[model samples]
Target: MEIKIDDLQGSGIIRLLEEHLADMHATSPAESVHALDVKALQHPSITFWSAAEGNSVLGCVALKSLSCDHGEIKSMRTSGAARNRGVATKLLNHLIADAKSRGFKQLSLETGTQAFFSAAHGLYAKHGFVDCEPFGDYQPDPNSKFMTLVLEQ
Candidate 1:
């Protein structure tokens, strides 16, 4: 699979992101949903990428700078047809490597506390993310679960 920075203008990625947003909204209330929209993901502090094979998009992930030494994972999603093929794993590993290369000392993420998010939670834990209090601009929310991994320099 080819993974590279995304332009956010591709129809395939746009559709995938829309579906992801709709799914999140349906599973959680608006107040508890923190997923960024297309516009928000395009901010200067955020770097987005897509995994693809030929013309088919496989998965996508984003890293958002929280501070000079910290970053947050955002909008991680794998296409339905691409599930179970290690696409999400590859994208995640890529993001982690990118963070390290950029001199980030830590990486963090916030995911839902619902069944729909169990797999994601497990994935993060497998990669060394430990439970943590809300970071950055986040406040404590019962519906949210935050995790962080301190990168070795």
Candidate 2:
């Protein structure tokens, strides 16, 4: 799989992001769904990436800069056909390394507490992320689980 920065203009990526938003809404209430739209992903503070094989998009992830020493993970999704193939894992590892290289002291993310997101929680835990209080503009919500990994400088 070839993973690289994406412009968020390709139809494939647009469609995938739409699907991601749809899934988030389906899994959580509208107010609880923090997944960003494609337009939001294009903001100057966000870096987007796509994983592909040949011309087929396999997965995508984005890293959003929260501060000089902090970053947030966003828009992590793997194609339905590519689940369990390490697509999200590779994208996450790539983002973590990039965050460290960029001098970020912490990487944080928010996910759902539902069973639908249990795998995600497990994945983050496997990567050494520990539970944390809400960060950024987030508030305490029973439906939301926050995790963070502190990077060694």
Tens digits of lDDT, candidate 2, 71-140:
9999999999899999989999999999999999999999999999998998999999999999999999
Please list the C-alpha lDDT of all candidates, in the order they appear.
0.94, 0.95
Question: Model 1, which residues run further than 4 Å from truth?
Answer: none
- Residue 29 in model 2: shift from native, Å? 0.7
- The stretch of ten residues in a row with the least summed lDDT in candidate 1 is 83-92
Model 1 C-alpha lDDT per residue in residues 14-127, reported as the tens digit of each score: 999998999999988899899999999999999999999998989899999999999999999999999989988899999999999999999999999989999899899988
The 10-residue segment of model 2 with minimum total lDDT is 8-17
**Which runs in model 2 stand beyond 4 Å of their true positions?**
none
Candidate 2 residue pairs that clash: none
Q: Please give the lDDT score for candidate 2.
A: 0.95
